[model samples]
Target: MSCVFLALKIGKVNWQPKLNKAAHHTSDYCSTEVILRRGQPFNISLNLKTTTQSWDNFTFIASTGPSPAESQQTKAIFSLSEEGASGWSATQEPSEPRCLSFTILSPADAVIGRYKLQLQVLAGNKSSSKVLGQFVLLFNPWCPGMF
Candidate 1:
C-alpha cells in the first residue's frame, strides 16, 4: 500500500475581494501541496485577512494523478472558513490564520510509481490553481521482504 499528503499556504497575509462596478466582490485564493507516507494523516493551514464580519464560502478542491489533464484517482472539496462578521469589519485588519486538514486512505492495491496531486481554489465562479509544494513519491518494488 502507498499513501499521499498535502499542505497549503497563500502568498500574502492581506487579501481583499476585487469589486466590480456594481460592488460585487470576489476574494483572491491560492493552494499548496503535501506528501505523506502510506496510512499517515496530514494537515493544512489557511490564512486570510479581511474587514468583513466573516469570510464565507471559501472553497477547495483536491485531486490525485500524474497530470491535470489526466484522470484524477481521487478528489474532494470543502469550505475553509466559518460564517459571521467580526468587529473589525469597518477597518483594515488581519484575521488570525486558520488551518484545514484531512487524511488520505491509500488504495489497498496502490501501484508503485510517481503520482500527482493538484489543488485548486475557487472564489465564486473564478478559479485559481497551484501544484505540488512537496516532493514526488517513488515506490520501490525491489525492497527487501517483497514478494
Candidate 2:
C-alpha cells in the first residue's frame, strides 16, 4: 500500500550531473529511472521538507506523461496529509519531510519516457508549486514472453 521511492531526481538538470536537493522518493535508486508493468500502479513516495504548520493543505502535481490529462499519463493533485503522515501536522515542528505516497500508471503500450514531479503546499489562502524531481518509466521486463 505504501512504498518509498528515493531513487528519482530532485529538480531539473541536463545530461550533465549537477548537485541539487536529494529527492526522497519511494524508489531506492533515485528519482529519474523507474521500471513498471502495464495497467498497474507503480507505488511511489517522496519526502519534502517544509516549515508549514499543517500538512493538510500540501499537494503534489506530477506529470509522467508528455500529453496532458488525455494521454492516460497525467496525474492529479496528491495531498501529503491524505497519503502519509508528516510530523509537522501532529507536532509544531520547524520543518520536516512530508512523506506522501502515490501511484504512477502506465498504459498497455506505454512508451518509455521521462516523468517529472512537482510539489505544491498551501498555507492560509496562498498556494505554490515547485519542481521537486523527475523519474523515467521503463517497461517491466517480467512480462510474459511472447510466443
Candidate 3:
C-alpha cells in the first residue's frame, strides 16, 4: 500500500472570489489574478506549516507604487488584533488549526495599483517575514461616501 499527502507551505495563502461576482459575464476576459476594490472587504486564508503560539504576533503589510513608503501613504502596516481607520486593516476570522483567516479592508482613498502583501510573524526576539502575494486595487466608485 502507498500513502500520499499534499503539503502546503507555511506562508502559502489562498484568496477567495477569484472571479468578480457581478462581472461574471466578463470572466473570460478578466485575468486570473486577485483584483479588489478600495473600501471593500476581502477574505484570505493562510496555511501554516507549523502551529502558532499564543505569544506569536502577526502583522500584515500592504504596499503599492514603485516606491512604497509609510510617510508617502503608499504603505500600510496592521496587526491581527486591531484594525486601522486611515489605511489598510486586517481582522482575524475563525479557522481550523494550522490555518489563519482574515478579512482585509482597504481605505477608500488608497492608491489604485498593484499592491504587494507581506506577513511578519514575531515570536519573542525572533521575527520572520514572508511575501504572501500581490493584488490589484481599483477605485470603488460605487462605494458609499466615494464621489
Candidate 4:
C-alpha cells in the first residue's frame, strides 16, 4: 500500500501523518512520525543517486499523493530487493547516494497540524527516470493532540 501523508495547519486544523514502516529494496527508507499523545515517530528518510544503467530490472516505487501525472487516487507501493546478483545491476556508473527510511503513523485523534510530505521515484521503464525528494510535516505545538 502506497500512502504518504503530512498535513499541518494549526490555528485552523489539518494534520495527517502515517506511514509506519518502509524500506524494501535498497536506496534508502525512513519516515516515522505518528505521535498524537506520546512521543517518538518523526524520521522521514529517502536518498538516491542514480546513473547506473544497463538494467536487467531495478524497481523502486514510492507514492503518497499528487504527481503520477497529478494523482489518480495516487498509488505507489512497491518493495522488491533480493532478486539476485547484488540486487540486479547493469552498471552505468554513478552510484554514491542510496538511502530509504519511512515510518509514520499518527492516530489518536490527531488535530493540531501541518503536513505535506511527498516523494517519488519510479525507474522501471521510460529509459530510467528520477525525481526523489519531498518533505514537510512539522510537529511540536506543545505536542499532545491525538483528539
Candidate 5:
C-alpha cells in the first residue's frame, strides 16, 4: 500500500495535494494530518525550485517522542537507498523534472507516535534542511506477523 504525501516546494510554492486513503488505510482518520502504519511503505512528492543535480544528496529524518533521540529508537535517519543504518528507508520513484517522488518504509518495530519529518539536502559543500511536516505512525494491525 502506497499513500501520497506532498511536502513543501523549495521556493515559491504550488500546492497540489492528493492523499490516497485506501493505500495508507487512513480513510478512517478524522484529522488533516497524515497517518501511516509501521512496516509499511508510503509515497511523498516534492517540487524543487531548481533541478536536482547528480551530486545532490537527499536525506530524510523521522523523529518521534518528546526527546526524539536516536539512541532511544525514537528517531530514524534514512536516505534514497534502503541500505541505510537506520531501519527506515526511502527509494526514489519515477517523477517529472524538478519534481521528486519517493517510496518510504518504516521499520516494523518503529515507535508508534507522532513523527516530525525533515528533509536534508547536501549540495556540494553546503547543506540545508527543512521541516517537511508531521505524521502519525501506528502499529500495523493488518500485518499477520505484527503481534
Candidate 6:
C-alpha cells in the first residue's frame, strides 16, 4: 500500500504596508514597522501568492486605532480598493502572484499608533485570515520653527 498525503498551501505576505524596513523593529510581530504620516496618502500594493486553491472572494481590512491582537475593540480603517493592481478583488485571483494596491487616506484627525492588518481569503465556505500583525502608524509633526 502506498501512502499519499496531499499537502496544503498557504498565502504569502509581500511588500511592507508601512513601506519601511527598519532593522530590529519587531513591534507587530510579523513584518517591519509601517510608518504612516499624518494626512498623507498611503498607497501600497498588497501582493499575495496562493499555493493551493483559487480565491472566490477576497477582502482586506485595516485598523483605525491601535489595538492588540485577538482583541474585540478593533476599528475598521478602510477596505482595499479593487482599482488597478491586476484587479484581484473583482475575480477569483488565480494561483499566480496576486496584486491588490490599497490606498489608505490617513484622516487629519487620525490617531497615531500601531494598527493591525488583516486579510480575508475565501474559497466558498472555507476562509482564512492572514493576519500580518500590527504596524506602527506614525504621526510626526515637524515644523521649521525657532528652537
Cα lDDT of all candidates, in order? 0.31, 0.42, 0.74, 0.30, 0.73, 0.44
Task: Give me the runs in candidate 2 sitting further than 4 Å from their true place.
Answer: 1-52, 65-67, 81-112, 141-147
Can you give the TM-score per candidate against the true fold? 0.35, 0.42, 0.81, 0.19, 0.81, 0.47
The true-versus-predicted C-alpha distance at residue 82 of model 3, in Å, is 4.3
Candidate 5 least-lDDT 10 residues? 1-10
Per-residue lDDT, model 3, residue 67, is 88
lDDT of 3 at 60: 89
Q: Give the per-residue Cα lDDT of candidate 6 at 25.
A: 30
Error of 2 at 133 (Å): 1.6
lDDT of 2 by residue, 1-147 (tens): 011122222233221122111222224455444433443344444454422133455555656665746236455445543222321111122322454444434444544566666666565566566675665655554433411
lDDT of 3 by residue, 67-132 (tens): 899898899898875665556788888899888788888888888899999987765566667788
lDDT of 5 by residue, 22-68 (tens): 66677887877788888877777777776755433788899998898
Residue 105 in model 3: shift from native, Å? Answer: 0.7
Model 3, runs deviating above 4 Å: 1-11, 18-29, 82-86
lDDT tens per residue, model 1, 1-147 = 011111234433211112211121112223221223332222332342222223333444434454532134343343443322211011112434342332223322333334443345444555545542432222324323334
Worst 10 residues of 6 by lDDT: 1-10
Winner on lDDT between 1 and 3 is: 3
Candidate 1: pairs in clash? 3-38, 5-34, 6-34, 7-33, 7-34, 53-85, 53-86, 54-85, 65-116
Model 6, 26-119: lDDT tens digits are: 2354543565554444444444443233333556555654443324434552334443332112222223344544454444444557766666
Off by over 4 Å in 5: 1-20, 82-86
Candidate 4 stretches with Cα past 4 Å from truth are: 1-38, 51-97, 100-111, 117-147
Q: Using TM-score, rank the candidates from best to worst.
A: 5, 3, 6, 2, 1, 4
Using lDDT, give the best candidate's number: 3
